[model samples]
Target: MAGVDPDDCCRGAHAAAQRGEFTQATVWDACRTGIRDAIESQLDDEQASPVIIDGLPTIGKTQHATDIAFGLDVPAAILTHRYETRDEHLNLAAEHQKTVAEIPTLDRDCPTRRGDHGSGWAERINDYRSRGASPTYLHYYLQDALPCMQDGDCPYLARWDAVEGADVVIGGPAHAALDRVVDDRVVIFDEDPGTAFRTEFDANQLSTAISTFLRRNDDLPVDNHFGLIGAATNESMDAIRDAIRDELSDNISIASPREAVDDDDGHAEAPTAVLAMLELGGPIIGDTAPAEYDWDDQLREEAGLDYVELPDGSQVVYDHAESRIIIRRPPDLTDSRAVVGLDGTPVEELWRGRLGVDDIESWRILCDDCRARYLRDVIGYTFVQTTSHVKPYSSGEYVNRRADFGLIEAVENRHETAPGVITTKSAAERLFEESPSEPFIDIQRVTNRIADVKHYGALRSSNDFTGTEVGIVLGSPHPGDRPLQITAALEGYTAVRDDEGKGTDLDYGIPDRPFLRHYREHKIAQAVLRFGRTTAATVYIHTGVLPEWLAEMVTAGPETVMIDERSEGQRGVIRALLDEAPGTAAEIAKRERVSIGEKQTRDWLKRLRSEGYVSRDDSQPYTWAADGLADAPHTARVRLPDLE
Candidate 1:
C-alpha cells in the first residue's frame, strides 16, 4: 500500500495538515491507498474498474492526478472540462519535469476548404453545417474544392501525430474522437463527468437529422424510425419518452454499410444521420450488421460503436415544453486501462444513476469533525447566509426591483473593501446598469480584470478573484424546478407535483433530499471557491440552501436585517447630531426631536451604519458618528429646521 507523507502533499494541504487539520490529511491518505489499490486490483483483471477521488475542493486532487499521470510508466490521458483547465494541468505537469501535448478542439479559427480563418470561414462553415452536412461530406468537399487539405498536411492531424507516443496526453471531453489513442491507457477525468456525458438537443436539430437521412436514403424503410418523433414533440413528457424509446428499438436494425478503414487512423466512417440516431438513443451493443447500401459516394461501413454506452443505467427523457431530448449516459471506456475521476462534491448516486457507471471505488473525507476543523481552523473562513429563502427566481426580481432586502448592503458592510458578487449574469448586468457610477473593473471588457462581479457559471477553474477579500453569493444557481424534477426522476426518484402546479415535491417520501440539493449546493461551493480557498476570506450567502460541509463552518447563522425605512428628515436629524459631536445614542436622541426613544435611535444608527452612513465604536456608551464627517465644521451639520 502506498502512503501519502504530509510533506509530499500540495502546499495548502501540507500547511493544513501541519496545523492539525486532519480532513485534507485523512482524505489524502485514503486517496493514496485507494487509488493504488483500485489501479492494482484492475491491472490483473481483463476490464479495469473506475476510481473516483472525491476530496474536498482545493484539497489537491488535481495535483495528485497530475502526479499520477506523470509518474505512471504507461501512457496516460487527462480530460478536463475546459481548454483553460487543460492548459492549467499542462503547466502543473511542467513543474513535475514532465512534458505533455494538448490535443486542441476545433473552433472558428480552424481551417476550412478556403484555408481562411476567423469570421468569413466560420460563417460559411456554420452555414454549411446548419444544413445538416456531415463531417465526412465536409472533409471530402474541402479536399476537392480547396488547395489546402488536398495534400492532407493538416495542423490538426499533425497535433495528434505529435502526441503519438508521449507519456501523457491532455485534452477536453472530446476524447471520444481519440478512439484507440487512449485505448488500454489510464484516463483521468479532472472534474465531474456529468456535463461531458450528458447530451441535449432540441426538436429542430432532430428533425434536421431525420431529413438528412431521408435525403440520402429516400427509398429506405427507415421513415418509421423518425416519423413518430415529430408527433412526439407535441405530446406529453411521458409520451415523448416512450415514442423516442420505441423509435430507438425500431431503428436498431437500420445499420450502416461495412466500415471503411481510413488511412489517417483506421477510423470507420458512419453517416451523419446514423451518428445522430445512435447518439439519441442507441443500445450498448458493440457491432451492427452491414447495410444494403451506403448513403455517401465514399464507401461507408457500420463502425463498431465505441463512442457511447447506454447500458441498463442510462436515461432518455424528452422535455416537452422545450421540445428537447436529453440523454445521460457514460462514455465508452471499454478499452481504457483504468479510469479515475476527480470531483470535489462526488454524488455516488449521480455517478451510478446519471452517468451510468457501476463498478467504481470512491475515496472521500467522511469525518465531520475533520472536515469542520479543516474549514474553520485551517482554511479560516466565516460563513453567513440570509434568513430569507432567496430562491433562484427571486434573485432576478430582487435585482430588477432594486430591492435586495438589505442582503447586498449587509455584505458590503461586513467587508472593509469592495467584495465580489456572484449571481446570474442577468442579475450582474442589472447591477451594472443600476449602479450610480462605473465599477472599478468592467465586467464586459476584460474577463481577467480585478472586477467585483462574477456570475455563477463563469467562476469554474478561475482564480481571478483571489484578491477579493469577500464574496457575496446572491442566490443559488438552481436549474429551475422542472429540470431538477427531471433529473431526480431520471435518477429513479419519484417526483410529486404540487396541487397548485407552482412547484414539485421531489423529496416527498424519498429517503433523503433529491438531487436538487446536490445540484444547487455544488454550484454554491464552486462559487465560494472563487475567493481562493487557501487564503482567509469571508463569504455571505443569500441562497436558500447551504451544503452540510459549509453549514458546519457558519459563524453567523441566517438572520434578516432590514434597513430602517425612516424619512430623510428624521435620518438627517440623526446625522446632524452625530456630525456635531460623537455621542451615545441616548445623548444624541436627547438633542434631537425625532419622537423616538434612545433604543429606537440606537437601532436607526445601526441601520445607518450598515448602509455606510454612520460609524460606531466599541465603548461603554457606544458612540456614533457620521462616517467621514466627524471632523467637519458646524456648517456641515444640517439643522432639523433646514430639512426639506
Candidate 2:
C-alpha cells in the first residue's frame, strides 16, 4: 500500500479508457504518488492524526479520496461543504464501483409533504417562509410529527438505514456531525467545514423565541427577566434556559398561521436560538475561556458573554450589526479513526489551534515548480488584470462604470469561446436589475458572451464553467475585520485595533499574511480557477486585491475606454462596434446586427472621438477604433437615455 504506484493507477485507467469506462487518468497520473506517500507516512505513526492533501484545482482530489476510502474497506464517510461538491462526490463514488448513500438536510424540504417530500419542496417552503408564515409549526411538522407519526416513508431517515448498510457514505459536514458518523471510520472532508462549526443566532431570533415560549408555556413557573438585549445577569439567562427546556420537553405543537402577517420583517420561525441555548446548557456562559479561540474583549462584552470553556472545547462570540451570537467548535475526529482532509488552501493554524486539531499533518501533491509547470504546459493559463472597483458596498455608479469598462476590455481581447463572470450575488442580481441603465447596458455585448455567471460562495468545487476560456472576476470576497479578528484570535495572531475603538472599516488589524490571503485573495482565485486550468484559459481579474502568487502571472490586457454624456443605446452600439474587428461604421453596425442606423453609429463614433473614447482614421471610409485609455476618465455626471 505504501508503494501504491501512480503507474499502476495510470495503467488501470488506460485499461478503463479502452473499455469506455469512466476515468480521470490524467489527474491520477499526475498526483497519485504524492497522495499515496502522504497516506503511507500517516499510517506508520502510532498516534492517529488528520492528514490534509493540499492540491491545486482539477487535480482529482475528490476522486483520489473516494478511491482511498474504498480501499480502506470500512464504512467510510466523505463530507463536503458545498451541495454541488457533495453531489459530485456521490456520482464520483458510484462511478468508482463503491456503494454510496447520501443524507440530505431537511432545511429546504416542505414540512407538510408527508411522503418523500417531492419536487418543489424547496419552493413551497420558501414561498411560505417569504410570506411571513410561521416556521415553528413547519419545524414541528417536519422534525417531530412527520417522521414519527406520518403514514408515508421519510426519505431523510430512510437514507440513514441505507447509509448503515453501504460501504461509503457521501453527505455534507453538518449531517456527518449530527449523525456521529465520523466515529470509528475513515472520514474525508472535501473542503473546510467552517460553516458546520460556526454556530450563529441573531438577537431578534432569541427575543422572538423567548416571547413565543413565555406566551405558550404560561403554565410553567418561568421568570420574565430573560432579556437578551442591554445589561443582563446570569440569573436572567438561567430563567430563559428553564423556559426553553420546558417548551422542548412538553413537545407542544403550534399550528402555523396560514395568513399571519407580522410587520416585524423577521421570519416567524422555530425557537432555533432557544433550542440552541438549551443545548449549550444556558445563555452561552461558561467559567473558563477556551484556548482555541481568540475572543475579542469588547466583542464578547457587547454580546454579554465571552469565550466560555465547554466540555467539547467550543467557544462563543458575537458579531455583525445584526448582533448574532456565534459558537465555533471543531468536529470530533477522535477515537483513533483515520481522518483525511482535502483542501487547496489549507490554513494550518485555523485547523490546528482554532479547530482544536492538535496533531495534524499537511501534504501538497504539487509543489511550486510542479504547479507552475502544470499551469504552463497543461493549463496554458493566461492572466488579465484590471483596476475596477468591484467591492459590493462601493459606490454603485463608480463600481458599475469601472466594471463595464474592464469587462468590455476583457471581452475585446478574449478568444472566440464564451466567457464566465464571477461577482458577488448582489452584483450578479444588479446586472439584471440595471440592464437598461448606462454602464450595465454598455456591457451588454460582454454579458451576451457570458456562458455562466456565479457568485463567490458557489464557485468552489463547481465544474459548470470549465469549458469557458475567458473568466471575469468582478471583486475579491472580503469577510471584513470582525471575522478577520475572530480568525486571527483563533489562529493565535495578534489583532491590532485602531485608536477609535472600532473594528469596522479597519483592514490592517490581522497582520497574518496567510489568513488575509485566505479571506481575500483566495476568493477571487477560486472564482477564476473554476474555469479550470486544464487547457488554454484567459482570466480577467477586475479588482486590485489579488494574491502575489496569482499576481506574478498577470499580463497586460486592453485598456478600459471611458465615455462621458453618452446615451445607453448609442453607447452600446459604439462599444459593440469597437469590440468588433476593424471596419467602417456601416460595416461594424451590420456585423453587430443592431437596430441603430449606420448614420447614428457614425455620429456616436464622432462624439466618442471628441470624448477620447475612440479614434477615427483619416481615410475616406473612416475606420473607428477604441482608444483604450487606461487613465482617469472625465468625472462629469450626466443622465443617459434608455435603449429603445
Candidate 3:
C-alpha cells in the first residue's frame, strides 16, 4: 500500500474526532496539522518571532500552545507570576522535571512556618539546589537556567537566566519580569497577573513600572529575539497599552487590534472568524455522553403521528393533537348511586327521563354523568361532587368541609356538577351575606373565581359539581382560606395598603403608619432630587406600588401626575420628554403605553427637571435623551446665592 501522507492522516483523524470516534493518539495526530499551521504563522514574521496564543478561559489556549511548540520543534516555557518566591520557582522546576519524566511525585509542601523553612533566604538556597547545584539535576536544567542565573549558588537564578535567553516563555504574571530581559529574546508572556493588576493599579503607577523596566534593558537585535504576549483578558491589553503610551512615549510600537493569525489569502484573520473557528464545535466531552434520549419517534407514536424520514437523514413528523389512550370507565353497578335531578332523582331514571318537567334536571344529571365517566375513564378516578343546585353550599362551607377532608384529598375528589349555576350577583350576594365585617372575608377572592369562569368560556357551567370545572371554578376563591390569605398578606406587607380595595378611592390606612410616613417623605425627596429644574412635563417616578406620599406629591403639582406604579420605569422616559414640552395627555398616554410606561428614564432625569421648572427657551419640547444629557459638558452651575 502507498504510504498515507501525514496531512491526510491528520485530516482523517480530525474527522473521526469530530464524529466522536477518534482515539487520543488519532486526535493528537490530526491536531498536529493545525498546530503546524499555528507554529508556521508564528515563525513567518521573524521580527515578531514569538507567537502569542490568546483565548478565553477553557478555549484550549494551553493545548494550542503545547501543540504549536511540539509540532514546530520549538522550546515553549510557561511563565507565571504566581511563582513569586524563589521557592515557588524551585518547586515549579521540580514539578516540570517530574512531569517530563512522567514520574508521580507529591506536590512540594508550601512552606507555612515563618522562622526557617519559609524564610526567603532558605528558599533562594533551595532554588539554587533544584536548578542543579545538586548533581542529580538534568542537563536541560543548565540550558534553561543560564540566562537569568545570577553568578551565585541560587537554584532558579540559572533557570531564570535560561528563561530570559530562551525562544519562548509561556506563563502568567511573570510578564512583569520580561522588561529586565534583552528585548530581542523571544519573550512570550502567557497572560494572567498583568490583566488583574490593571484593575487595582492607578494608570501612573503602571506607567512608572513599565518605564523603569524598559529603560534598564538594552534592546536585542530584531533577528535574534522576538516578543510575544498572550492575554486572555481584553482589559489587560488596554491597560498595558495605556501604560506603555504614558511611560515609553513614542518608543514602543503597539500592534493594532488584529486576529492573531492570517488566513489562506495572507490577510490577518478577522476577529469574528477566529472566534467562530475556535468555537466551531459544541460542548466538551465528559466521562459520558449527554443524557439525551431519542424520544422524537416515541413521542410521535404516542401522539398518533406518522414520521417521514427525508433523503438528508432528517425526519419530519405530525403528532396527535390530543391523547390516544382512552381512560377506563367506572363500574355502572346499581349500588353506585349518582344524583339524577336537582331533587335527588336516580341517575338511571335521569338518563331516561320525561320531556319538560324533568328535562333540565335530567340534562344536568346527564352532563354530570358524562363528566364523571370521562374523568373515571380518562383520568382514572370518580370525582366527588362538591356543589349542586339542589343542595347549594357557600364557598366557605365547601372550604370548611374541604379542610376537614384535608386539602390534598379534597382537591383530588372535588368536582362541580352544574356549570353556569353561579351568577355574578349570586357570587357577590354570597360574599356580602357571609360575614361582611370579617377581616378576611376575601370578597375579591370570590370575584376572581367568577371571573375565571367568564375567561374560560361557556363550555362548562360555573356551579357544576364535576371535578374538572369545579376545580377551576373554585380555584379563584379557594385561595382565600386563612392559610393562603395569610401568606398573600405577608407577601404584600410593603408598608402601604388602601383602606378600600379600589385604588381610585381615597380610603387608606397605614398599617405601619410611622414607617409609611417616613417612606413617603423620603420618596418625595428622592423625586425632588431626581427632577432638578426642568418641569412642566410629566416625570415618571418608578417606585413600584405607589406610596400615598408619592401620590400626594404628584397631586400637589399639576405638572406632576402620579399615574399607576405599573407605568413607572418604562414610562419615565416619555414623561421626561413630555416634561420638556407641553403635550396632550393622550399623546403622553400613547407614548407611555408604547414604551411599556416604565419610568426608568424619568427616575434618571427627575433631579434635573422639577414639576414646573422650564428651560430658558421653551421653544423646544423637553425630550429625554439619556446619552445626550450624560455626554453634555457642565459649563456653569446655577445655584441660589443665599442657599449656597
lDDT of 2: 0.56
| Candidate 1 runs further than 4 Å off | 1-38, 44-48, 96-99, 108-118, 126-141, 146-152, 222-315, 353-356, 393-395, 398-410, 434-451, 489-510, 560-644
**CA lDDT, every model vs. true structure:** 0.54, 0.56, 0.26
Q: Residue by residue across 409-491, what tens digits does model 3's lDDT show?
A: 21222221212122122332443345443222233333333312221122111122222232222211211222221211222
Candidate 1 to truth, TM:
0.69
Q: Flag regions of model 2 displaced more than 4 Å.
A: 1-30, 37-46, 95-98, 104-152, 210-222, 225-305, 312-314, 320-322, 352-356, 388-398, 402-406, 409-414, 435-440, 486-507, 557-644
Q: Sort all candidates by lDDT, best to worst.
A: 2, 1, 3
lDDT, model 2, position 326? 59
Worst 10 contiguous positions by lDDT, candidate 1: 635-644
lDDT of 2 at 547: 58
Whole-structure CA lDDT of model 3: 0.26
Cα lDDT tens digits for candidate 2, 1-644? 12334543332233334455433454455455445545555556647467777667777787777777777645678888777777777777766676777764555333444324454655555555553353443444455444322655445454557777777887877654443566666677787766565545567754554455444545644432254221122444556545544555454322123322332333333333334333432234543332334445654444233334333355544443444555565665664356677777777666665335786777665555445555645677777665534354222333564344444443534355667778776666665346544432444544555677788877667788876777778755666556766666555454545556322233444444666667777777777778755567877777766655666666543243222333554645554654566668887667544557788878866766665667778898998776752221222212211111
Residue 354, model 1: Cα distance from true site in angstroms: 5.8
Residue-level lDDT of model 1, residues 268-287, one tens digit each, is: 11232333343433222222
Give the top-scoring candidate (lDDT). Answer: 2
Which scores better on lDDT, 1 or 2? 2
